[model samples]
Target: MTTPAHVAIIMDGNGRWAKARGLPRLAGHRAGVEALRQSVKTASRLGIEWLTVYAFSSENWSRPPSEVSDLLGLLKLFIRRDLAELHRSGVRVRVIGERDDLQPDIRLLLEEAESLTAGNGALNLVIAFNYGGRDEIVRAMRKIAADVEAGRTSSASITPQTVSEALDTNGIPDPDLVIRTSGEMRLSNFLLWQAAYSELIFLPCLWPDFTPEQFEEALRQFSVRERRFGGRNERDVVSSSA
Candidate 1:
């Protein structure tokens, strides 16, 4: 099977998973964290170079205060508890999102994770916390605007590559395959700009229940598809008729 160089996942259905089990939402979130740990291992073993997961979104703040608090607590716990193991496993941690207003402690922990794993190269683990795809594009635009205003570069000279470099994911390659669990069929404001041509796989299993087998299956699904971007290939002509 063809293994993608990069894979991104929208981990969804935690609350629904908890509801199905008659457990609290936090319980589901906790299980989701374990799923994440296992996913990291699976990705490494599969030789996937980059794995980006949608952990928390900017819009998630609209959730109930108690739930939000619980999520934040879980983030802290996960980082403090898992950072050592992640670093030792040769996973380079990268966090992308708006962090200017985050709690000082939370910000520090995120920075520490990136710094500690900066030298690791086995896998790239990107956590999209407090992230929104539109927000990321807006931020990139703002940076470009600022540069233009400062006479750093003419507006006409700015290209797609320039905008991409200004975004939080600068230097990171776009995902080759994007997966979403819990049967969701939308991107849900995740990696909007970067995933323009990524192959998508929507899984029926919820985030907490996602397994290595499912991950491997998604790769299997990706391997047979032909990606021609906007252009047409001979395969497309035959496949379209079939």
Candidate 2:
């Protein structure tokens, strides 16, 4: 079977999903977590090497205090509950974002989870919590500038590869497929630099209701497409099944 080396998702419409059922927003968020668990299992079974999810954006801080607290609480619970199982299943967990804003306890848990699963080889699961693409780019640039100032590298050597190496996803491959639930067409500032040529699949299902079948459909669709990567002809594709 054809499998994407990496897949990224923008899990959206949780608020709407909750409202439609007369449930609180946090209820939908909780359901989203269950969906995420299923997605991880399905992706691993399907042989996907890497998966990234936009769990919380930098802009999410504007939400009400109660909601923010609930989200953070859920994150803590997730780490505590899933770390052992993930490690056992050979899934490596990594959080990519500005983690200084997180609570100290939460930070500690995240660090521990990462360390525990660092040697896993089944799948690399990246959760973008409090993450922003623009902020990531700026952070990368700042690191590069500091290195250059320290005479570690010359300005002429500051290529795209150099910038990519400084980013949080330094050792990870760029996503081959980007799926956004709730039918959103925009990137919403997620993986701006890395998703330049990714195959985008906009799903109509809300994040809480996303299913493995839907994910399989996305993969099947991706398998049929001829990825030219900006080239005009299908000949550029190394393998085209359809």
**Top candidate by lDDT:** 1
Q: Write the per-residue lDDT of candidate 2 for residues 2-53, one digit (tens) a residue.
A: 7999999999988899999999999999999999999999999999999999
Which residue pairs in candidate 2 collide?
Answer: none
Please give the distance, in angstroms, between residue 60's alpha carbon in candidate 1 and its true position after superposition: 0.6
Model 1, 97-146: lDDT tens digits are 99998999989999999999999999999999999999999999999999
lDDT of model number 1: 0.96
- lDDT score at residue 70, model 2, on the 0-100 scale: 89
What lDDT would each prediction earn against the true structure? Answer: 0.96, 0.92
**What would the TM-score be for candidate 2 when compared with the true structure?**
0.95
**Reference-based lDDT, residue 81, model 1:** 97
Q: What lDDT is reached at residue 155 by model 2?
A: 97
- Each candidate structure's TM-score, on Cα atoms with residue i matched to residue i, is 0.97, 0.95
C-alpha root-mean-square deviation, each candidate: 2.0, 3.2
**Against the true structure, whose TM-score is highest?**
1
